[model samples]
Target: MSSRTQHSIIDLVSLEKEKINRLFSTADQLALNPFIPSKGFGKTGALLFFEASTRTRMSFETACAQIGVHPMLLDGKSGSSLEKGETLEDTVLNVAAMKPAFVVIRSGDDLDFNDITTKLQMPVINAGWGKKGHPTQALLDAYTIRKHLGKIEGQKVLIVGDARHSRVAASHVELAAKLNYEVAFCGPEGFLPERFDVKVFKNFSEGLAWATVAMALRVQLERHVTKYSLANYRKNFGFTVENLKGLSDKALIMHPGPINQGTEMDTEVLQKDSRCRVLDQVSNGVLIRQAILLEVLGGL
Candidate 1:
């Protein structure tokens, strides 16, 4: 069995390429037979999400159930103790003391996982951590890309919009770079992150033409770095219907939802014929997370 106990997927680059490939293979198997029997039966997983989530939360819950693990979810808006005054550390201690099979936490940007994991005895998976990284998303994204495109290596991917505040984009960048995929970002001037050797395109059209995959990102209002110009955003960077004429037929559209329909992409672009893989990402999320759970709960 794989020995990924106590491992936290903080960043994609930190994971060995072989392990990643193994996880992807596992995910592919799980996708083929979601109801297949496996380990992790009778085990419990804690879902402690401090932020609002749709895909990550639901897909994780589905994965746990599919893998025969009981999942106990704790949301920030659900009148949890954290809403009153309890600190994350205190809450973590109390939760960890219960000795659940594993803990899946989606904490704020500042909560350092490197420090937190050292203190924990059980595996602590990062569901999402601030604007830093969402490793699982990256895994599933790579899975989706590989599923459709045959391989992630040598694929030209363009991550568009909200680059600075998107944890998914950061994770994808690291994963793409590690896997030797050519990755670029296209967004407004101030929205892009400061440091990265990869190419940055100011024009989305240029990016769309160059990439085999175009991954659109949501404009995060929660991370409020600068004012979003909707008109300019649609004109310059969005996957508008008019721009579809210029888009390469070989290039497919992707979005880590929940998408702001009219903002990053037009409503028409979401249709079946638009070649959008948003639903594929959602489908792969379950299998990828199942692989994560299996890896972290290895042989326990």
Candidate 2:
């Protein structure tokens, strides 16, 4: 079934109509409203991330500011007492002591503790939770999909590149399934996620030919460590100009950025493809994240 539910925007299945409507409406009003750099004076806040971040981190900070919420930023790796053997739950719980409207986190591993995800008496919005989910990215992606395609119910959205290992792709996979998209995955054969119901692919041509949206993932610099060979990594499942020709004219291109040049994809494709919305993805992220933080922290 559709992921738009009623109260919670936790997942696609749990997202409801009114909540979505509110989000879009808020975003619309925000666009038409004033120009304030720091609108989030008292309503919102953000937590630090131990891992590297760009879109996910700044977008959340921007989102909160758009909705009039002041931010309390922290560094994930260097901030707090985490280096002294502090657990994720304890650290989050301690941060919660400040009684900020909501706590946003981005951990590299998928460790959804009850104390953090459920306890703490306040809402905990996962900025990009471990290996599990990046709900904000999913939101912006869905928004981008809807903006470009109008509706996603039956769209054949192919998530190519690093299928299994990406928090972005993983979240997209789960949400795509929940929203009834014809979701498929592609990567180096052995790198694909084994647990999902989506169709997996090894050949870029076959994957691109049938897709309405071709979503490439970022190739981490550590593909050498994970896969043991950069040359093989490029040869196995990398995206090149040759693969681009396989896409149908109706097909739109996408990528989660911080792109590894000439590794997973060609930079020119992002620029040359008339249907590419990679920049739009970042722009929409700020709007969608504003929507999420507002819903979670607005009334509280």
Candidate 3:
């Protein structure tokens, strides 16, 4: 039996490349299947959102059904007890009674996650944790990049947009670095964190002046509650129509989705760029997420 515990996905650094490759290979096979994945879920069910999302929910649901897990979901807003006053721990504990193979939850704060995972006996995957990490999205994003570029390691990837507020950006930085991709951090000085090891670029032109893939992180309005300024951030860190013109032609483009039009990118560039593989990214997510559920729970 595999000694690797169900809870091991908490840190991508600890995951062996062979295991990840197996998941990738499995996801690749699912693309040949005849139907769309479902809302019923398969072996691994999700808690879904503490925050709202579209692609993450759809792809996760699709992935679960494709793997044959019966998905049970609870959107806290539409729910009964939650609106009345049920704690996250209580909600998770109550849900575990039905014996889900796994639980994936997106929490509001990084530290808030400990309570949820601790309350559930089954394996749990963190969907996104505040400004800290979006592990699964990173996994699917990397899967898309590998599929699009036909490889992952040693590729040049430029991450552009609001680095400070994006958990996706933080997750990708760690993931890309682990995969041996040469990663660059691109954004305004105030929005980009100074702690990472990658090369940093204040100007969009400088970030595009390389043979590399470009990933634009979204600018969420919630960041204003923190140290970052939204208006200045939009003006400086935002990727403009002009910047995309200078990017490497062969380079693939990526985003986490619900991109801020005119903020992170121009509408025309998003619609027309050959390198922008955003749609493909979501498609790839369903496959990748299906593989994740399969790994944690025995599946079809």
Model 3 lDDT tens row, 1-300: 232254436556656677778878878877787243433343447555777888888788776665567677876456557787777666777777777777777767734665556556677777778877887888888888788788888887788877777888777777775777777788766567766666888787777877478888886556654555656665665555666777888788888888888778777778887788888888888887777776776434
Cα deviation of 186, candidate 3, in Å = 1.3
The residue-level lDDT of candidate 2 at 28 comes to 55
Q: Which should have the higher TM-score, number 2 or number 3?
A: 3
lDDT (10s digit) by residue, model 2, range 1-300: 211112224444455545655666666555566233332456646465766788878887777766677778876657468778887677777777877776777776645633355565566666776667776787678778877888767888888766667777777776765667788888776567776777877776788888898887776546435454556665655556666778877767887777776776667776776878889989888877776765664432
Clash-forming residue pairs, model 1: none
lDDT of 1: 0.82
Taking all chains together, the TM-score of candidate 1 against the true structure is 0.94
Residues 176-199, model 1: lDDT tens digits:
877889889989887788867779
Model 1, residue 39: distance off in Å is 2.4
Clashes of each: 0, 14, 9
Clashing pairs in 3: 40-71, 41-69, 41-70, 41-71, 42-64, 42-68, 42-69, 42-70, 43-69
Predicted structure with the largest lDDT when compared to the true one: 1
- Off by more than 4 A, model 2: 1-13, 28-41, 220-236, 298-300
Q: 1 or 2, which is superior by TM-score?
A: 1
Shift of residue 40 alpha carbon in model 1, Å: 1.1
Question: Using lDDT as the measure, what is the rank order of every candidate, best first?
Answer: 1, 3, 2
